[model samples]
Target: MRAFLRFKNSLSLAFVAFFATTSLVSSEIADFTAFDVNLTLALLRKDQKIEVVVRDQVTDGCWTKSNAAKTAVEKNLIIAGYENIVPADDNAFFTIEVSALGYDTGGNNCAVYVSLRAISGEADRYYMNDHEVMAINLREQFSSSTLLTGPKSDMTSRINDTLYEKSDELIVAINAARNSLRKKISDTTISEQKKNGLLSAFSLD
Candidate 1:
């Protein structure tokens, strides 16, 4: 009987040790969503007449992604020194939509798909569409045998990280697409004075 009790105690200690290690790993991942919006905005320049709109369907109940798009637009305006441009949406020559495609979970992984589309004019189709996929490496915390049985807290943290990564990608894609629009506007045959005025206002020089 004493030997059996000793064996049970050993199992209990091992279980505790395993969970403690898991908690430590989870803390190391950090929360990516906490810093993504501000970081992305800092990296983008306000050098174009582009408006940012985060689709409601994508950002619904997702504050991190929503703030990312919102902050990017605000930062772009600030960087261009055009904060005075009221009703930016109406005056903007181009609109960029940041949308969330969907989420995928299986195969020991969590994946999120994000898309960006640029549109101009009432009849003009989207001039650019870009997609980015962000994923969390679940293998580090889960194995095939225990994939679906991991701690909920760990899984939630991983998903947050993926969402944040995807938001950052959207920011980069929008900036690049907006640059393309800028080049297209510059190449047009508009009058020099009008072109220069628009360009200067947008800080596109």
Candidate 2:
């Protein structure tokens, strides 16, 4: 009977240790959104640098041990910036908190909040997302000749512009020139030979 009791105790110890390790790996706390992180990165100028403060929220019903997981996440972010921007999603580190019970079980999911603050007022939420940023290594999206537009602001090249390219101005101009030539033909009262001469002068051929 004593040996059976000792074996049971050992099993319980193994179970507890496994539960603790799993909690350490899975528990996360985050309160920032991806919109905020992307906006902040966009505001960075060619040589300018900005600091971001990422934090997660704690729910009243959170388990006491979840705090350690939050700390681990914070340490990782502080040491290494979210360097990769081409993540499957923008909100990679953000965490969502849900009310769950028991030690080995976690809740459904949680939402994260992310924020960026430029030390100087020169940067705002709009500037972060709307303006070009230099800190991130963004991959260029591929475009075909049919698409025409490349990701460039200056349209000095034959390649189409990223924003606006291949406007219908050429078509409109051609139509206007044709109409003017037709009007000249109608206004002429010369003989057919003279009319043909005038048409040739107009370069309608």
Winning model by lDDT: 1
Candidate 2: stretches off by over 4 Å: 1-167
lDDT by residue for model 1 (85-138), tens: 234445443455545433324444333344444443211113345644432221
lDDT of each: 0.39, 0.28
Model 2 residue 118 distance off true place after TM-score fit, in angstroms:
43
- Our model 1 lands, by Cα RMSD against the true structure, at 26.5
What is residue 89's positional error in candidate 1, in angstroms?
6.7
How many steric overlaps are in each model, in order? 0, 11
* Candidate whose TM-score is highest: 1
TM-score, each model? 0.32, 0.19
